[model samples]
Target: MATWPRREYFYYFTKMMPTGFTLTVDLDVTATKEWLAARDLKFNAAYLYLVSKVIAQTPEFRVYRDNTGQLQRFDVIHPAYSVMHADDHSISSLWTAYDPDFTQFYQNYLADLAEYGDQRTPMPKAPQSENTYMIGSIPWTHFTSYTPLPFTPLNTFFPVIQAGKFEQEAKRWQMPLSLTIHHAVADGYHVSQFFEQLQLAFDHPEAWLAS
Candidate 1:
């Protein structure tokens, strides 16, 4: 666990707003589809890979408070996402460690699906860790706005991310991405940086997918 500098304003600001905040934006994912189609890749795997890769670059996204009330930044973070079961029409939450390598991440996601995809009941909650981010997707709808459940007073700093259905228009695809973060750990500047990085990843998937 790494603490923020005492001089940083966020160090004091987070103490007051412990529950955090969120932001939602729509993004062009045309290049993402093209890149995946050229390589015969699964959209969900590629999309999550890009999202996780971009998130790994932002330190503020990995901030969390310890039991003792000290803010800590993790060197790495993983994704804990919701997976729907086809057998029972239920959702199961699963967690997988993050890896920069797209192939490894995709394979791990597949493994997780195989293990929990058919379960009728929810899987056990993932272990609490400073190095985890919450993620989910609603593939059936293309929404303009989204709001997640309210956060408790001591909610962890892990960012919650949701991706809506992608729509095709004039040979291009677009998707809505909603991100909720703790205001104490991140502000508009940090959220803007995250969106910029995510767009770059979507615009140039070949750069990261090749490796």
Candidate 2:
């Protein structure tokens, strides 16, 4: 295992090698009565917690990867976040990635906003053939729309945000998933288990609240 800071090049030349395809059913956020009773914070917190736990313990999820090469456990969940950065400025909050503590995360989020009140930065230009680059000192006027789970690759991620759907994106959306893997880490059953865990967490979110 390597605990290494990402290389600058790591951000550049970003293309993944995909090996396997495991189809999944998307759970409707409001499909069941139990979902509302569970509360929004409950599901959101649990989902973040579970994703954090899985990725922290399993390095594979962090890699832009696939598991077609090995028969190991591919049933792990990865973290995908929605960040709203625009052509002109820096984003003050990264609340979507916080794990297990919404109170602190929300507090910090507000703090960032307050401290940088009305501060706006010029948008950084993106390279040719890509959408706008959305990171750096934030613009005072750019209204932040959202920062949530990243359901797809970076190149193809923003469109979903524009459309506002993950289940539809994951299953029916035009974008395809790409993963590069050595295949030694996971397999079919593992991929199935990943979805099962997600469903279980959604079904039983009361058990996921912080005490």
lDDT of 1: 0.78
Question: Which regions of candidate 2 fall more than 4 Å away from where they truly are?
Answer: 1-18, 28-46, 54-80, 84-184
Q: Kindly give the stretch of ten consecutive residues in candidate 2 with the minimal lDDT sum.
A: 155-164
lDDT tens readout by residue for model 1, 1-211: 2444532556566555444567888889988788889888888888778888888888878766677876676877888777886666678777777788888998888887777666665655445444767788999999877778863664467678999999887878889999987676678898999999899889888787777
TM-score per model over all chains: 0.88, 0.39
Per-residue lDDT of candidate 2, residues 1-211 (tens digit):
1333333223333434432232324443332224434554433334345444434444433343323421122233323322344554443222233434545543433453444434443322112222211212111222223333445543221111111233334333221111222233334554455545545544554453333
lDDT of 1 at 142: 92
Model 1 misses residue 105 by how many Å?
A: 1.0
Number of the top-ranking candidate, with lDDT as the measure: 1
Q: What is the lDDT of residue 12 in candidate 1?
A: 62
Top-TM-score structure, candidate number: 1
Query: Which segments of model 1 are wrong by more than 4 Å?
Result: 1-8, 11-19, 124-130
